[model samples]
Target: MHELGIMTGVMESVETAARDAGATRVLEVRLTVGEMTEAIPDALEFAFEALSEQNELFDGAKLLITMVKPHSCCLACGAEFDHDRFHMFCPQCDSFALELLAGRELHIDSIEVDLPDD
Candidate 1:
């Protein structure tokens, strides 16, 4: 599964961000995953739980995922339609030059952290 690699990237990014922010511990990480990404949330969680070992920032952190649906707009006909992972073609006019309006995104929405005492 590519989830492991995705998780590693996420962890590394958040870890660096947390450290830079002077956070002693990371409490939670929120992510917005696109529907077209076809990522298994449970499997990703499992990988995250397994991979985050002895990481002071992520040892007991929580992972939250929000799924987004794929949307597309036809460049030829200027029609908008819902895009599916299995089919990348435009539904309205069967155009191959459809522009993706949504989905296929994997990024961090936000993070919760415990700041050190001042």
Candidate 2:
């Protein structure tokens, strides 16, 4: 699954940040998955668990994901509606020319790390 590669990249970035901050271990990684991203949260988590086996920093890290729904704005009637990739038309005026407001956001929201003691 594509989630494997995506999770790998995420973990890499998290690790880089953790290292820069002098962290010896990553405790948790929080992500926000938008409806339009087409990413499976469970699959990503599974991939993280599998891929992190060789990595000491993220070996036992927790992954938390939050799903965000797609939103659309109609240009014709200046209306907005919750949208999905399958149905992008505006609900209020049945307009096909709807601009997406929020969606397709696959980002790391927060990272918790254990810093090395001084």
Candidate 3:
């Protein structure tokens, strides 16, 4: 699944950041994912677990995901509403002209790491 590739990239970035910050270990990773990306939560978690186990920095690290619903704005009626992936049409005017306001994001929000003590 594409989730593997996605997690691979995420792990690379996280590892680099943690090392650069002198982090001894990663505590948690918070990710914001949107429904439009179609990335399954379970798959992502599985991928994270598999990848994290390979790295010492990620031992016992927690992966927290925040799911974002699809939200769009109607270009015709200037109305905003939430919708599913299949239905993107504006509910107020029934127009197909819509601009997506959210639900297409796949990014790391924050990372909690244990830094070296002085």
Candidate 4:
């Protein structure tokens, strides 16, 4: 799945940042994934496990994912609500005019690394 590709990119970035910070090992990675992105959590976890095994820096690293529900604001009634990807209409006014306030986000919130003792 595309999770592999996604994890590959994430690992590359984490590696670079960890190295730049003089980290001896990566301890954890925290990610925020939106439901609208359609990225499967199980698949993402599997990908992370597979990729991490290939890198020494990621050994025993933990992957923490925060799932974000799709949130939107209605342009018609100024109503804000949470909804699934399929139903995007505003509940208050039943209007299709909506602006997404959150979700569709794929971001690395933070990384925990073991830095060299200097």
Instruction: Give the top-scoring candidate (lDDT).
Output: 3
Against the true structure, candidate 1 has what lDDT? Answer: 0.87
For each candidate, the alpha-carbon lDDT, in order, equals: 0.87, 0.89, 0.96, 0.94
Question: Which lDDT tens digits does candidate 4 get at residues 1-118?
Answer: 9889988999999999999999999999999999998999999999999998999999999999999999999999999999998999999999999999899999999999998888
* Model 2 TM-score, 2 decimals: 0.94
Order of all candidates by TM-score, from best down to worst? Answer: 3, 4, 2, 1
* Per-model TM values vs. the true structure: 0.88, 0.94, 0.96, 0.95
Candidate 4 achieves a global lDDT of 0.94
Question: lDDT-based ranking, best first?
Answer: 3, 4, 2, 1
Tens-digit lDDT string for candidate 3 (1-98): 99999999998999999999999999999999999999999999999999988999999999999999999999999999999999988889999999
Residue 43 lDDT, candidate 2, scale 0-100? 95
Candidate 2, residue 12: the lDDT equals 88
Clash numbers, per candidate: 0, 0, 0, 0
Which segments of model 3 are wrong by more than 4 Å? none
Best by TM-score: 3
Clashes of 3: 0
Cand. 2 Cα-lDDT: 0.89
Better of 1 and 4 by lDDT: 4
